[model samples]
Target: MLLHIQFSPEPIPAALPALSLGSETGAFVEFRGFVRGEEGDHTIGGLVYETYQPMAEREITRIAEALVVDHPVQAVRILHRLGPVPVGEAAICLGVAARHRAEAFAFLASFMDRLKKDVPIWKTDTLPAA
Candidate 1:
């Protein structure tokens, strides 16, 4: 199994991520989370995210590994943008590859659920629209 997890201050690239897939691989799934125009009841301009880097990466790695074997996943990649993320732009991306579609989707779902609860990445609302 392969795993790549990262946090960056730059905007996420628009191109899709690539994984070394063998003939046995039959499915690839991806997800992107964007900053919405509204947060709660207020119109939002953007969002600012913060993290401690090392500890956050460690926790994220642990969360992903726990589901890998059970989901029978082959490769996984994650990217989260720090600092400010503008509305309608992607703040995070996730990719998973597996030998079957069900496994790939399952792994994606499980990983996302765990990430929200366990990760230390924090988000603060940016300037509200005037």
Candidate 2:
């Protein structure tokens, strides 16, 4: 079981779970959440994220661990950006490797949902300049 969770100020790396792939891995799914240009009626410029690193990392690890145990996955890599993230920039990336595409897809989507709701990370939306 391969698991990696990191809170980075830099952008999420393009090559992540690619390196964590195992011999039994047959399917890989990567999901990225970006700072959108708009949030509801508000026009967003970017976002500032703050987190209690120790606690947030632990919570994220728990989510990943549950994913591996609940699903048939070979590996899971989760990365979240801290500080400022510009619109269109990726804020979160989740990668999952499994023996089949269905499990990988399901796990990736479910993991992302869980991360957003359960993780201790918080984001402040920045409104666009007037």
Candidate 3:
């Protein structure tokens, strides 16, 4: 699924139950990234994420499509939260449905790794008072 690049004030859950696949899909893999409370000894009050909308969306879509071609993924959903995000809240969620558990697991991992390195998204941390 293609997603919109926008900011939200709502907290993102660690697990998104709403993102699921049917029985026809033998395996379902989900990846969720949370905001860390600390970064290099700096207390993280929150995170500010920014994305180049057009390029970010395009790159994500391309990655999803490539996963489908390379793996047995039947359906995929990639969701990323923008703006201020607090610790323990989800920053990103990726769901993958495939014919086998192994493929689903591997593809999900690769997707997240690639998205982080390739997608046009940047993050800045808001540090708390030292």
Candidate 4:
């Protein structure tokens, strides 16, 4: 399996790296986690995310790697933005390529759920809507 992770201070890019897939890769799934206009019951402009960098990356990698035991994942790519992110902008982007759609979907769902609970990434602050 191919695993790739990237972090940036700038806004998450609109274009993503192509996942290298072979003929056996029949399904490719992509997900983008965007900053919403609201946080909890309050309105907001954006959010600032913080992470320990090394540990965050390592933990997320572990989560992805562990999911491989059940999913026929061919390639996994993740991109996360650090620092301030505006509303409607992407904070995270993930791609999963697998031999079948079922595995890809399951892997994506499980990975996201695990990431929210396990990863050290957090919303350090919120931007006031202007």
> Which of 2 and 3 is the better model by lDDT?
2
What lDDT does each candidate get? 0.87, 0.80, 0.73, 0.89
Backbone clashes in model 1, listed as residue pairs: none
Number of the top lDDT candidate: 4
Clash pairs, model 2 backbone: none
List, residue by residue over 1-130, the lDDT tens digit for candidate 1.
7889889989888987556487978888999999988888889889999987898889878987789768988999999999988888899999998988898899999999998888988896585664
| Per-prediction TM-score to the true structure, in the order listed | 0.93, 0.87, 0.83, 0.94
lDDT of 2 at 58: 84
lDDT of 3 by residue, 38-109 (tens): 877788776888788789888877887787666767767767788777777788877777778888888888
Local error of candidate 4 at 84, Å? 0.4
Model 2 misses residue 73 by how many Å? Answer: 0.6
Regions of model 3 farther than 4 Å from truth: 1-9, 13-15, 18-21, 127-130
Ranking by lDDT: 4, 1, 2, 3
Candidate 2 per-residue C-alpha lDDT over 1-130 given as tens digits, one digit per residue, 9 for 90 to 100:
6887878999886666363465777888888888888777788788889898898888877877787666778877778899988888899887777888888888888787887798788886574633
Per-residue C-alpha lDDT of model 4 across residues 59-86, encoded as one tens digit per residue = 9889988999988789998888989999
- In model 2, how large is the Cα lDDT of residue 54? 93
Assess the local accuracy of residue 33 in candidate 1 as a C-alpha lDDT between 0 and 100.
Answer: 96
What's the TM for model 3? 0.83
